[model samples]
Target: MFRHAFRRFPLRVFGLVALAFVMANILGGLIGTALAATIGLAVFLPLFLFKILMVLMFFRFLMSFVGGYGPRRPCSRGRIKDRLQEPPAEPTKEETEWREHVRLARKELDELFPDAEQFIE
Candidate 1:
């Protein structure tokens, strides 16, 4: 289903995001508390906001990458798999005959024309 569509690339990305989220939340809390005690609320507030943004972004990115669980199927209107799998059309018999005729005509012209030196004008 989604397993074939997504592959392992997105799963690896989700794992990395989750790791970053954990690290940021833990470190940001510790660092934010210390900075507030020393530098005050003005600087600490921005740092806190930045940490919150990072957490939210990481979760959003992770969820978007996660694969769906279900049977594999295309849209209701048409089968995407069939559309992708279809082979290109081969030339029709008429087209093939036309190409062959053109080749024979070119050969005949070359024989008749021979060389420019052989021609009078």
Candidate 2:
């Protein structure tokens, strides 16, 4: 649906709508707070929260259309073969050393405080 619009209409419309949505929410929140204080906080709080939530959802929707601010690329279909073709990344020396240190510490802890393990469980 959006892809069709992107093809037909200028992309600027989407950007403008997103910006307007954000500005409206900000102004609405400020006005709502003033109204709530004069009338009652209870009514204003929910309205404020709702407007904020709507703005957040609108921003997320806009981000999806914006391609995360990068060059848009067509998505590719995939299978397990694609995953298998990529080699696994190797662990760094620091990571290996950290794991070994943890193992040794655990071993020492087990010997030094068997009761500690029982308490943890």
Candidate 3:
């Protein structure tokens, strides 16, 4: 019965069915490739970002040490420490105010808990 019905259809129907199958296969393959690419990006993108960030951090570390502000090593004779330890700079107004605040806070704490000192240290 199906062959009889199929015979009633023109040969164009067979060609159309074949073309539809080919189009569907092509579409499926394209979708599969897109999904695979999406998955690859999802897996590798963060690793790539982390690699870039690590490179940036390494450069920052190198740059930080490039200036004279980085940590210094002692000289063979150990006089580097002595030479580097110059007289302290004069305190600014903010420093003086901070010191006064700390002194008052300490005095108040001492008055509040004279016996607390025994527990300290």
How does each model score on TM-score?
0.25, 0.35, 0.50
Give the Å error, residue 37, model 2.
43
The window of 10 residues in a row where model 3 has the poorest summed lDDT is: 68-77
Could you give candidate 3's per-residue lDDT for residues 1-121 as a string of tens digits? 9998778688778789999999999999999999999999999999999999999888766756554322453332355566678787899999999999999999999999989978979
Q: Considering only N, C-alpha and C atoms within 3 Å, which residue pairs clash in candidate 1?
A: none
lDDT of 2 by residue, 12-114 (tens): 7877898999999999999998887878767778899999999988876676565342234222224345666889879999999999999999999889998
The models' CA-based lDDT, in order, is 0.78, 0.78, 0.83
Taking the tens digit of each residue's C-alpha lDDT, what string does model 1 give over 1-68?
A: 78775798788898999999999999999999988777887777899999999998887666554442
Q: Order the numbered candidates by TM-score, best leading.
A: 3, 2, 1
Model 2: residues with Cα > 4 Å off, grouped in runs:
1-63, 66-69, 72-85
Runs with alpha carbons beyond 4 Å of true place in candidate 3 = 1-10, 68-121
Q: Please give the RMSD to the true structure for each candidate, in Å.
A: 29.2, 26.2, 8.0
**Better candidate by TM-score, 1 or 2:** 2
